[model samples]
Target: MAVSVYRGFHLQSAPNSTEVWQVKIKNHVLTGNLAAIKKSIDWWCETASLIDPREFESLNAKREESTGALHEDFNGYTLKNDTGAPNAWYCFFNGRLIKGSKLAIQKHIEAYLVAKQRAEAKQAQQKK
Candidate 1:
């Protein structure tokens, strides 16, 4: 299960027109493992947070108006693309499409969980 994190911005060429943007983060495939994938997602989200909030806010506002609803803050995970005909999962951030297969997304999430566990373990050690 290879997994990776992708980041990009969404831009609309015109009102009610199609939006497009380039992914900033490079695509990566990790070993087949759910944990690895999850970790990737977590890491990606954290990294995205470092971006200027204004940029994200701008994108979110546009996306909300285009989609007709406000969305959760850019937590680095969202359904980017999905067709009812075929089962698929995609994650997005700030209206940018973060392309990845279901398996890849799952792995990214797992990676996050793993990182969390490690942090907890470290904290526990310090407490002693």
Candidate 2:
């Protein structure tokens, strides 16, 4: 079976009774058994989301040391975009992972800008 996420990543299982998933994120391919993959994804969705930014940095550093690659950190989540610009970003944290396309990142960035504008507007009004 093949599953698609973020329009840039796909998960496919090898034909036969194998429980391994071949997850393709742009040009990167990750092959993990079902149990490990599920555990990783579950951790990302459940545990990593609750981690503090400070603690996450420490944890991410360890991940880079072990994995030997730079993973961009965002609010405790590790984002990996090896497929170049305008592609999807694979987010991994707390032993879990997910994929998000450029559009997804843009949406988050836009939201941040809106929040900043709101905060600035409030500050200006208070100073007036």
lDDT of all predictions, in order shown? 0.44, 0.56
TM-score of 1: 0.30
**Which lDDT tens digits does candidate 2 get at residues 36-104?**
444444444566432222344455566566553335666544577764444557764335665677457
lDDT of each residue in 1-128, candidate 1, tens digit only: 12224333222122332332222334432221223233344456777433332345465566555553222222355444333212255565335555555556657666776788999999999999
Worst 10 residues of 1 by lDDT: 9-18
Error of 2 at 50 (Å): 41
| Residue ranges of candidate 2 with Cα displaced over 4 Å | 1-80, 84-87, 90-99
lDDT of 2: 0.56
Error of 2 at 69 (Å): 14
True-vs-predicted CA distance for residue 42, candidate 2, Å = 25
